[model samples]
Structure formats: structure tokens, C-alpha cells
Target: MSPTTLTDSSRVLCPETQSPQTARPKVTTVMVKTPRVAAISLDYVLYIESAKNGPLSRRQGLSPIKWEKIVPSPRPAPMEADIVSFTWPRFQTEAILHLANQRKALQAFLFKNLVEGNLLWLAYIKDHCDYGLAVQIHGATDFLNFSNAVYNAFPARVAVKITMDNLTHLAYEEAMRAHFQHHRQIAKAIKSIRVHASVTSLTSLTVVHPDHPQQVMEVLTKDLPEWAEAIVANHPKVTTRMPPQTTNFVWVDGRKRPTTHPLDAPPSKHNTGPEFTTPRNRTAATEPCSSPSDVDDIEVIQISSGTAATSNHTKPMAPASPELESHHMETYIHVAHIHKGDKLTWARLLNHGIVHWLFFRSSSKVELIGLGFPIGIA
Candidate 1:
């Protein structure tokens, strides 16, 4: 015969002890390996077992009794909210507007895309903090004003793609053909509004999708050859050339300067190291420290763009000139794309910028085919 199926059941009963410390409800679990028999009283036997271990000792074949304290389950923690909202900074948007206004091909791309309905504009404002890039999503429903949309979104400093072949794209192409027939010279027509009249010529203005890695690398190779070479060689130090005027675009290992010696000599003491010129005053002298007490007699010479320190005994160093200040300031190259999208949110855009997204699209409604950001050449 097959082994009898065993089942376990538990029930709580009032405490038999009058002691307040032992007043917790008694719990008894029954493990019955055999079918119910009329000769045995299961409830009475369980009650006797719960009161003491005497019943277990008396019953020749009874299972040993066990006592366990009940523990409550813990509640789960709350989840974080995914949605976040923010306004696109005005300066970044302004830079994009400037690029669109300056470049005919860019304006035409924006115009044609705006007319078609779906546009995804992505831009990397190199100056916009350390954040990488931001993408603005526009659906067909909000194509009323092209320039306004661009200023609200951003410009294309990297690459722009047109993925639609619908009536709008065709109409724009036909208009471009008529302009080409009228002007004859492609160069002259490209300089005017006719530049935006066609979507066919956009390839020349910006790198097309699926062709970014090669094109972006080509631009980087030409503009910042040292960086490109270092990236390919996987070298820590790039000794061939100085970094571009822009700093912090990417980390170049072994670029950290050696610890500088303190240059905190009193006004009377002269610097023995190389003499550096102050850009503002055209005087040659070593840089000073904010606090003289920090350093002993050692010299501390710093090479950076900032306001010079002042001393009660020594005259204040000249401030940076306007041109120098502007040169040190951050500049950016933005890349814009035209694509399809529906639901868009500010949180999604912020997240896109934060994650250093190489080539990923989060919008469920949009398909990103091409993206390009040419390394900005000063």
C-alpha cells in the first residue's frame, strides 16, 4: 500500500497557566499520517498535548510536540516616482537658435521636419554643466511655429535625420527641385531659404544616420586628432599636442599635473622658478596664494583663469580681461534630429542627459535611427 499522506494543521487556544508571563495563547499543530479512526479523539489528544508533554510520552506512537512563537510579516517600502519636470535653460536654446539662423541646411531640416509632424532634436551643450546631451521630442500636433519650436527645443550641432517619405517630405523635395531648376547653381541656392526647400541636400549639411561613427570619428580625427589617436591607441597620456581650448570633454589619463610647490614668498622675496606673465597687466611675476599662513617659504605658482588674490601690504592683481573671460567660458555644438514621437516628458529628457546615453532611446513611441555630435573645434 502507498505510504499514508501526512497533513499538518495548526490552531491557537487560551493559555492554561494563570501567570501573566505565560498567558500567551497556546498553539498546537497536528500531523496526522493515518486516516481518522473512530477509536481515537483527535481534539482531546491535541488539547492534552498542548497543555503538557505527558500526553506525548504516554502515547506510544505519537509525534513529538513542538512550540514556536508567531512573528508578524514586515510591510514593503514605497517606490520612487519616475516623472521629473524642468525648463530648458535659455542660454542653450539661444545657442541652438543662433546655429539654425546661421546655417541654411539646419533651418531647412527643421522646417521640413516641422511640416512633416514628428521631430526629435538632440543637442549636447558642452557648456551646460557636466551633463551630456538633451533631446526634445515634438509630435505632429505641435508643428505650428518652426523657429519657436527650435528655440524651445535646441539646435543640431551633431547630426539630424529625416525618416519620413510621406507627402510632406515629397512636397519639400519637389520645391527644392524647382529651386534647383531656377537657380541652376547648387551653391548659390544653398545659401538662401531654398536651402530649407529640400530634404535631399541635408546629407551635406549634417552627418546622416547609420553613418555617425565614421563621420563623427572623421571630424574628431581632423579637429582633435590627438584625442582621436589616443582613443584608438588606448593610451593614458597624449603628449603629441595640447588639449583643445575646451577642457573636460573627456578624461585623458596622466593629464593630472604634479603637486605644485608653494609660491607664498613675501612681497620682498623673488621667485626663482620660471617667470609667468599676468595677462591683464603684462607684468611678469609668480601667482599668489589666498592665505599666506597655509604655506611656508615655499613658492606656489598656479596657472588658471580667475580673479587674482589681494594682500593688505601688496596691491591686488589685475582681473581677467573680457576677451580672456570669454575664451575661458564654455561653448557647445548641438546635434538635432527629426523623428517620430508621441508621449514626451521633461523627466525623460533630464534622465537622457544624465545617463551619458551613447545611442539609446527611451521614448516608447519614437524610433531613433541616427545621431551625431561632431567634436566642437575651437
Candidate 2:
């Protein structure tokens, strides 16, 4: 009739039923923490050589070294031609492709899959490309979109030099100013402008029209920060150019508006998406419903949500096959270290779109140098 007592080693026995009961130790669950990936920027310098043009070479080199020195002869091709003649479409294509591949590789390294929110900016000190057609075509916009999807994502900005040659016609200068002014009417804009004049022209022109010199000078110098600030006081979106150093000006511009969080209550509602949040612990363990695969393979982990919080603890339910894993990871061979001597070859490559290919291949290297960002991360 005694009640049963259970101890560490003793089993329980029921008096009437003659049944034994055992106790099991409590199981402790532990959650391993995954480190969050840090954001980074990548920078690069594409030192392309000038193309061969017998006449232009003589003009740029043989002409008076000083901007002020008088040259009775007609000026040769503009300085712009001398600096970026080698960066042709073909070369750009090659560079772009190289960057694209590098981007893919880097995405895999960090997330174990390709997630397109990487930010990348292109910097060219004296490049004269009409526009970044190469970058746009490859995936620059896509990169921007991905960054915008995440609040912490940094927007990429392209920096380059705008020279006298970039102004195709003397008449276009007025139009460029008007166009810039239009942007100013909408928002505060920062622009870098550079003015170049032969020393003789600077001195003689200033003297000839001292009162209105800054006006003509303003036409050439409008994009400078000092000038931009003056304009911005009136027009929030003023475009000012930075002063020229060595007749060369490198400036940064916000090609797109700076990104803002919804919580911040920005003036513009251009960003299109739900407010972003740090991906914490919201991931689903099942395969993404949108994915094509249902095999539950190691290579294909289902991402229930795009939030980073969900991604932290999420793991592929199954391990990937050896071949599948190997294919996902690739190695980039450093084909060459572009140097001053290789300028001629680079020039030729630029003309052929091979430069673009090279750019793609060396994207990681260039990003490291140009923007201080890892190529893969961007």
C-alpha cells in the first residue's frame, strides 16, 4: 500500500500494476550564432593607353606644353581624345563581363548563393565616355535596385572627369547649364565643374571682359563646388563643377538621389518597396515556394523570406553534391597586372570590347583599388 518513490538510480514500481517507470534527463537546446557580413566598397583605376593617331599625337605632345602658350597652328584633337581614346566599347564590354563574373563569385562566397544586392561604383579620373552604357547594360541598375531593397544597403556612385572635350559643341554648353538648372529646381544637387584655358586665354580673356569674365568663366566653371554652392542657395539642385587642377578635374556626383529609409520621412517617395529591416530570425526552413527545384538538394536551400534575419540560421536541409558544389565555386586567374607599358595593348583591346571583358575578369582587383570595396561583395 506504500506509494512509489523514484530516485536517480531507482525505477518506480506500482503496487497493484507491477509496472516500472523510468525518468529521462532533460535535453538542452543550443542555438549557434552566425556572424553578420560587413558591408564594403570597391574601387579601381582603368589605366588605358591612348590610341595611335599620328596627327593627334604630334598635336598633344608637340603643342606648347603650357595652356597659356600661344600656338599659331590650329589646336589638335581635344585633350579628351588623348586620355580616353583607348577605352573603346569593345574593351569596356570585356571589363564589364569580367566585373559581372566577379560579382557572381563574390555573392556566392558570402551568402552561399547569388543575392543581387551588391553595390558597385565606377571611377574614372579622366575618362570621356558619353555615358556609362557599358555598366548600365551589364547590371549597374540591377545592383542599384538590390541595394535599395535593403535599408542598410549602400548606393553606388560613379565618379569620373568631365573635360572640355566632353562638351561636344561650344553651343551645347548653354544647354548643359539649362539642363543642370532644371535638376536644381527639383532638388539640391552637387556637381564638380572644371574650366580650362590656355594661360594666354585666361589672361587676355579676363582683361578683355573683366566684368563679364566670371560669366564666361561661370559657363565653364558652373559645375565647381564654389559655383554650385552659389547656385544652390537659389536653386536647391544646383550643379557646380570643381575647379580644375592640372586642367584635369575629378569630381563625385550623385547620379541618383541618396537613399533614405521610410522611417526617415524623406521628401521624395522614389524608393519602391516595403521598409527594410535587418534579417534576424524570420527565415523558413522549407524550400522557397518560388524556386523551381523540389528535390531538397544541398545546393538548393529554400529561402522562405528575403530578409537577412531569416538567412542567418537557415541552412540547406541537405548537403550539396560534390559536382554541384564545385560548379558553384569558381576561381579567377589573374591574367595580367595592367601597367604603364601595357598601354598600347590596352588601347587596342579597348577598341575591340576586349577591355570590357578584361574589366569583368579584373573587376575584383579594380574594385579593391577604386572604391576600397571587395569585388565579390559588390
Choose the strongest candidate by lDDT.
2
By summed lDDT, which 10 consecutive residues of candidate 1 come out lowest? Answer: 37-46
lDDT of 1 by residue, 3-51 (tens): 5643443222445744455566889988532221111000000112223
lDDT score, residue 298, model 2? 28
Put down candidate 2 lDDT per residue, 170-197, tens digits, no spaces.
Answer: 3468778887886774344332222233
Clashes of each: 12, 56
Error of 2 at 16 (Å): 14
The total number of steric clashes, by the backbone 3 Å criterion, in model 2 comes to 56
By TM-score, the best candidate is: 2
Give the Cα error of residue 217 in candidate 1, in Å: 61
lDDT of 2: 0.31
